[model samples]
Target: MNMNKKELPSLLLLPGLLCNERLWQNQVNNLVDICQPFVADFSQDDSIEAMARRVLDRAPEQFFLAGLSMGGYVAFEIMRQAPERVTRLALFDTMARLDEPERAATRKGLLRLAEEGRFIGVTPRLLPNLIHKDKLNTPVADEVMKMAAELGKEVFLKQQTAILNRSDSIPTLSKIKQPTIIVVGEDDKLTPPEESVNMAKAIPNAQLHRIPKCGHLPPLEYPQLTTELLRDWILQEA
Candidate 1:
């Protein structure tokens, strides 16, 4: 493998909805020894295709890729557009199907709240759904809220729009040959564990990991474990 004088392959981390570089800050800092990490700016576009293009424009020629939640949607789109560029894949708390009617309606309601200026960031009603119930008041939970709040309205709308219009990626799954890992929280109310399992099953040579006591935001709730898992995933095919 061409290391470009770097010790390990480049790893591109795509954050979920309303997330920023801070989303992968931990992994970036922790995995520095094994990978040259870059976190994508997902706020620059309103469609998954556009977002993938932007990220691809800046990413290394080839890299390991990871996406969580909404990022997973964008990941699938990226894989659709450039399967050859991806060396491996890591999907966390994500799904390959188009949004369910109920979930789409819920997203519309949240977007409505944002439009009405009622709640710019993720609101209290939605916070509990994001983290494990026991961790609702933890620092990690606060950080997630802070990230959402700081990203604010424009970003929220753009991401939600991208997610709402994202294609059902199941058709593309069978074609993914990269070494992949699907990670999810056991208590994730948003995407749940079964989705990760199903996604792992759909992708060729994919692994599945369930973080106990975690919720939608596993990176925040289990930063060290998540980072470690990601590091291992990167090395699997290296």
Candidate 2:
């Protein structure tokens, strides 16, 4: 290991549903100069509490924590479970509330498809909901599909179950003492920018940013911008 690398702070990143380490590959590679980034494996757990516990068990004693979508749910659990260990918080394309009836129904329907062995991750019909319309034909869309396919059905099942059962985190937002940032894609249809707005308002001194023409998976959809945003957040004075 490089001696200087030891001096860098740890940055623990958690990915969303059907996403693996590949979801954060760009940020991991680009942010190496300022922080040691670690992507947690969220595939084994069937609940957010269990996922958060698994991450806390393996994460550094103290570190910066960031999560996207389903990962955001786990991040909230981590804060509740071990707030002292998190130096800062960053939420991307996620919300603090539990699923609405319509959303829950959609998730349940997808779960049924997977259970029936008909899981086709991130198909063309679903791409619009996950990314900006302009990116539908781009490599970014391909990467999203690739990630889903790579993680496959079992991981999807676990993630969906965890998300479905996650707690309502809005009430706990004001209690977060860490310097926090909430980011969302301007064109994000799933979580939407409004969700980030509500989170920013709830968390004390939290900063909110909306990336234009992007969607739920900003780290992959706009890697350079996402890297810069994270780099700035990591270096910002608390």
Candidate 3:
């Protein structure tokens, strides 16, 4: 099942907050030649567990799974439900910790705003925190704004509320024995490198990699690194 072989494992990419399939466009295109990659849809589900179930319901019998930010939370739930089904794991710019009280409170506030038809505020206020200081002024900011626009107010509220209530999966990482990769952007502010370090240490057989000059949305900010690491990790496990 190594890279030396031709039949690579299927890869399922889960996007971060307020994102859809467009988030993984670069990864999809870059890795399509090496392996089959599908972007999981979570807009229909309002809870992390339910989202995981929805994705699993449509996933192949067995394959590699990867996710970012909130999607990382769902990926862990998938691991909990169908550990035997995952051949490999990759988590990018995500944390293994549960929502602390302060974080939960912030999420709730954002959820409330979204519920009140404030999707516009969510993007501007939140996007800066996700990326590095320099990126806040670049085209990346415009891109993020455009993506958030696609999510709409209703989806924003649902996703934010779901993140506010997500369960702690730090303890579950140790139980996962598959070849796992923990990726973090060097410039990500939302989920710091410390978070990825903790996740790498907790997950069995996991390796951590950093994408320089990238932010929380590495799949979009540095798609080449994301695709290369994902491809390498899945192939190494095979």
Candidate 4:
């Protein structure tokens, strides 16, 4: 789709767990000319499905959508509700299956920590798992920490609870007909490259791209690669 200067598609971006609007600022800066992007407030709703509905309610009549981690879960629900309204889709560092038993235990533990006012303790430990090991002591780490702090304990718990109970969407992926892009960080221990690969395989037309030397949050750690992949995917879809 070679859109003229004024014919760009609007994009709805979803942030991950314990994240805020800052996560997608780099993406917006990089794609503003080709896409008008809006960040979804997934923190407001308690359930993944409800959050998806709320986001879709405020989205353009039809638009391109991209989501990361927890956001991907909500995006899948949005796709389920309004497949026709979506012109293209992007899923990054996320999974299609619901939380597994071990993962649920992990989420439950995190929630318990949050409920006990130990959210700060959890953040330090959790943040490292979301970014590259080398970035653990850098400015990027500070930025992730800042975003998590900005999200606050109350909202973090809500996001975690919503994720714990999110529905399985693997079966629904194949039903989607829009152009799709699935990206993963080669070092992403949280979602893992295998999970993202499986999702790409399930979605008939999805293209999978893995970023090297990065972890779960590629937009923050490797903004240029993320933007390039997304821009290319958007151009291909058009």
Candidate 5:
């Protein structure tokens, strides 16, 4: 028993900053019967490299990997660290470049606010960027704020720091040889769809999918379609 692990199509999912297992709830529930699914813990780590290593240490010998936003950054780091272990890749609502100066400045401001215990400035205001404007008053909006609140300030700071420290992954985009898919929300203002286009263009044999009426958090904003895209991507190579 100690020498043998179960043989299954292991799908290891790494969630974005401030996102716990709840982030991949829909995918986890839907894919469990089809494969061995695992949601990674990134809250304890302050660096993307550490997060990648942690996932590698705990993941199956070889698995399909999907990550959203900051998790996408971690996914790139994973490829840089251990490309041999990732059988396929799905990058959703993410970019491969370093943050713009203004974006970095915004992150610093949020870090300062978190350090001063002023989380209110970050949520509702930051929430809109995470979802479509028309859904501003919906329960989905409330859920996003609630999740961030529960994750608290420390995790936020760690995540922000990790983003700040992330190098330009653009240089490595062409190197990914796995079965890759770049999915973005048509209305995603944060990472935007253009960046996803660029990623898909750079990666060999990578496919791009855009979720309609969706924003940055595609998995939660459009669960049904998100799950469908993932299922299709998984089956493409199977």
Candidate 6:
């Protein structure tokens, strides 16, 4: 390990459903100078509480925290569980609310498919909801699908169950005291920019950034831009 790396703050990154460290590969590689990046494994746990506990158990005493989509839900749980242990918070393409009726129905449908052993991760039909139209045929889409495929069906079932049963985090937003940043893609269909807008409004002193021509997965859709956003947030003064 580099001596400078040991001196930097640890950035604990949480990936969304059907995602792994690959989702944060760019951030981890690019932010090495400013922070030690650690991507939490959400594969073992089936509930947000358990997932948050897993992260807290492995996390440094005090670290910067960031989560995307389903990972954002776990971040909220982490804040609820150990806010004092966190130095900063960053949420990307996520919301503070529980699954709406329509969204719940969609998740249930997918869950049913997986249960019947018909799980096809990130299919061509679902690419539009997960990435920008321009990224549909690009390497970005391939990376997203690869992450989903590698995680496989069992992890998908666990992640979806956790997402479906996650708590409503709206009330917990105002209690966040750490310097926070909320980011969303302008064309994100899954969570939308408005969700990030509301989160920014709720968390005191939280900053919100909207990336144009992006979708649900900004870290993959716009890795450099995401890295820079995270760099600025991590380097922000007290």
TM-score per candidate, chains pooled: 0.95, 0.97, 0.91, 0.94, 0.94, 0.97
Q: What lDDT is reached at residue 233 by model 1?
A: 87
Tens-digit lDDT track of model 6 for 143-219: 98999999999999999999999999999999999999999999999998988999999999999999999999999
Best-performing candidate as measured by lDDT = 6
By lDDT, the better pick of 3 and 5 is 5
Ordered from best to worst lDDT, the candidate numbers read: 6, 2, 1, 4, 5, 3
Off by over 4 Å in 2: 1-4
RMSD versus native structure for model 6: 1.5
Q: Mark the 10 consecutive residues where model 5 has the least summed lDDT.
A: 1-10
Residue 31 in model 5: lDDT = 77
Clashing pairs counted in every model: 0, 0, 2, 1, 0, 0
lDDT, candidate 5, 1-238, per-residue tens? 0214365588888788778788788898997656777888888888899889999988877889999999999999999999989989999999999988999999899899889988662366777788888778887777777777788888888888998998789989999999999999899989999999999999998999988888899888887788888888887853
lDDT (C-alpha) at residue 165 in model 2: 89
| Residue 139, model 5: Cα distance from true site in angstroms | 2.8
Q: Which 10 residues in a row give candidate 3 its minimum summed lDDT?
A: 1-10
Can you write out model 1's per-residue Cα lDDT over 1-238, one digit (the tens) per residue? 2246475789888899988888788898999788888888888799999999998888878888999998899899999889999989999999998888998999899889878887658666678888988887678777888899898898888899889999899999999988889999999998989888888888888889999999998788899999999978877644
- Model 6 TM: 0.97
RMSD score of candidate 2 (Å)? 1.6
Which consecutive 10 residues in model 1 have the weakest lDDT in total? 1-10
- The C-alpha stretches of model 1 lying farther than 4 A from their native spots are 1-7
Give me candidate 5's TM-score against the actual structure: 0.94
lDDT (CA) per prediction: 0.87, 0.92, 0.81, 0.86, 0.86, 0.93
* Tens-digit lDDT string for candidate 3 (92-124): 889978877887888887777666666473356
User: What would the per-residue lDDT of candidate 4 be over residues 90-130, giving only the tens digit for each residue?
Assistant: 99999999877997998899889889988883356776688
> Cα-based RMSD of the predictions, in order?
2.2, 1.6, 3.4, 2.8, 2.1, 1.5
